[model samples]
Target: MKKENLIFGIYPVIEALKSETDLDKVYIQKGIENPKIDSIVKQIESLNITINFVPIEKLDRLTRSNHQGIVAITSPIAFHSLETIVEEVLASNTLPLFLVLDQISDVRNFGAILRTAECTGVHAVIVQKKGGAPVSGDTVKASAGAIFNIPICKVDHIKDAIFYLQGSGIRTIAATEKTKNSIYTTNLNQGIAIIMGSEGKGVSNSVLNLVDEKAALPLLGEINSLNVSVASGVFLYETVRQRTQ
Candidate 1:
């Protein structure tokens, strides 16, 4: 059964897989144990498609009809290659700005961030393929159609993308509260890739250690943190302001 981008039921998903369907991710209910499920899992693994094991209730909420503990979410927008986007941008003679998302699981935040990235003239938005939020219909709606306007790259690892951007002469900056230096004092006019982590944990320690610089948003109001999307806008527009000023 197809509902928007979702293709549910066991046979339907198997058919989708056989048809070389472009699925964003497939969700299988956890701890069911079946031969067909094992076969489907192996097939999905062989194709390198993202698969998630979720609770039965999740599959229930995803669709009211019989799902057989399987559902596939398809992406509305085609993803671009990071190397291609970087190469095209470098050849253009424009200051490059890229947004790298680490473990951003919320579709709304992802969409809002994409909107902000597009508005700020970011060259491309990079996200880890498996761990990040799936580009579902909600994500497209949340992005306010900006997902279609901007180039998005899905990478295997966020660190490798950071390394490539760094090799390309673009500074990798992680937005984290761990650093005392704020965004206002940091240089943003240069080619840079800003890494925004999840809302709850901020940037990972491993990622924080690898960045060229770590900058924080000043928190004088005692909130300690800002929503990832809001923080992204502030950082992006700061770069915009610096460039315009």
Candidate 2:
């Protein structure tokens, strides 16, 4: 974590939240009771920022300075809104190609996907605010600075984002082994959004139900599944190939 990316102390964190700063996550000391802490909790809840309760020892490990039982990590890049990005893409007269990440918690995987998306000319990447990986220095490095080049929208839920994409005439596709359709068979030249699930769990049942199509990469070897990043690259490049041909 970079020093510039972290804002510690209770009052400072509260002010940052009030000022609408782009915070990745907030860490609060567990079992701490104070008026200011309560106020901060209320504001964070209202803002829908991800918060974690940790022990004093954990806080001590994070910083030696007086943290006042709270620390907020800021995102390196400001998140884009799904609706705004969609509107802009529509106005641009180009096919809308979006990548929706479902609970991809690994920073490296997230960064790798962003790199692939950028190389493939994806219009935007959408992720759920709570479960997705934070945009940190590690992620920026893993992305080969491609994270800065692409637009990332952090929504409250993946399912809602799928609904919005479908309503906007964008076909939503899920990449999972559970599906019978192969990526090679799917038409990706049209406006589409691809949903890639987390490493541990495939796409959530809720999101899978809403997607317009389900496509999977053929795996003939012993491995049951490819890494999420690799799968995303395959899907993104296939879309590029389709559009180009």
Candidate 3:
């Protein structure tokens, strides 16, 4: 974490939130209570940003300067509103192609996925505010600057995004070996959102239960799975293959 990426002190964070700055998360020293902080917390909740109640020692490690019991990490890219993206994509002639990430913790993996998503013309990416990698400089590098070319949305949970997409008439599918359905066998020519899970856990059972469909890439190798990024690319191109035909 670089010093330039951090915003410390009370009023700075309040202004950042009010101005709709791209913030990854906020760390507040536990036991510090103030009315302004209460307002900040409310704003954070409204924006669906993550809030961490860390100790002063944690805040110290983040910055040598006074953090005033609160420090916020700025995101390298601004986030799009999920509703706005959905409405724009739905109203357009372009197909509503979205990628929903379920806890992709590796910044490198997340960036590579974004690269593939951009290359394949994904409308937008829906990611959870927490439990995922922050959009750091490394992420921007791995994305090959594709991060700027794509719109990303941060939500409180991925499942709710799936519901919104489904309600808007977009099909939601999960890429997991837990299902017998093959990606090639499944239809991807229509409006769809593909959910790629974490590198370790494929997809949470809760999210898996709500998705409209579950798909798996047929692997013949001894290893049962592929790296999440490679798998994401394969899934993305397959959709491209389907739609182009």
Candidate 4:
């Protein structure tokens, strides 16, 4: 077993833990009771394998092969520190513009938003380590390959990111329908970070509270909301317009 490879079944996972292969994470079937399994769990805990107790059906679905009521998914991407990315941007000569997505799960929307962010000269796109969609091939294609060029940093918390950006002299703006202030009225000429939430649910409460300004797109039609990606483009390009002015 290798650190990069996935090892299924309780025994294999236990053996991997005993050996040199670092266990990234483990998924065990919830409500399972077995003495051998208990011993395996102790070893996994000692090795610091991030354990997730999931339904038995999930383990079955992931593999037709015998999973022994447990599975482990190998780590895909090495996480980049939010502080490091922001520092790198601030250390550079140019002003910074960042896009922070809160629980944005749709790959298409993520891709389109990234495309817009990159085109609008945003320095980086930050997202939570979990819940958000991965930078998959489809996302890259949807972004028209902008994913390769634009820097993306995964953080533990969105609020922390907002605070960090503000400390670095970057304003945090939230795009929400709940706000009456129009995006047009907000000054995006300064270094700033725009936070956009998912399609159904807007910005998380934690992030909403941290935004320096909560702005909305002026909508005259009956529709209550615009597509998240479309709305993001409006907000991002607005910054471009203000900067160009």
The model with the greatest lDDT is 3
- For model 2 the TM-score comes to 0.82
Give candidate 3's error at residue 128 in angstroms: 0.5
Full ranking by TM-score: 2, 1, 3, 4
Instruction: Summarize candidate 3's per-residue lDDT along 16-46 as a digit string, tens digits.
Output: 8767677877888999988888878888766
Worst-scoring 10-residue span by lDDT in model 2:
129-138
How do the residues 97-201 of candidate 4 rate in per-residue lDDT, one tens digit apiece? 899999888889989998998898888899876667655556767898888778888777788888889998998999998888989998888888999998889
Better of 2 and 4 by TM-score: 2
lDDT, ranked from best to worst: 3, 1, 2, 4
Candidate 3: list runs displaced more than 4 Å.
1-6, 10-21, 24-73
Predicted model with the maximum TM-score: 2
lDDT of 2 by residue, 1-245 (tens): 67787899988997897777878678899999889988988877765566899998888888778998998888789888889999999999999999999989888998999999999999999988675677776789999999999999988788889889999999999998988899999999999999999999989888888888999999999989999999999999999999998
Judge candidate 3 against the unseen true structure and give its global Cα lDDT, from 0 to 1. 0.90
Instruction: List, residue by residue over 1-245, the lDDT tens digit for candidate 1.
Output: 35788999888888887875667788999998888988999987765567899999999999987999888887688889999999999999999999999989888999999999999999999998676777766778999999999999988899899989999999999999998998999999999999999878888888888899999999989678999999999999999999999
Q: What is the lDDT of residue 61 in candidate 3?
A: 94
Show the colliding residue pairs in model 1: none
Clashing pairs in 4: none
**Which 10 consecutive residues of model 3 have the lowest summed lDDT?**
41-50
Cα displacement (angstroms), candidate 4, residue 123, comes to 0.8
How much lDDT does candidate 1 score?
0.89
Sequence-dependent TM-score of model 1: 0.80
C-alpha TM-scores of all predictions: 0.80, 0.82, 0.78, 0.71
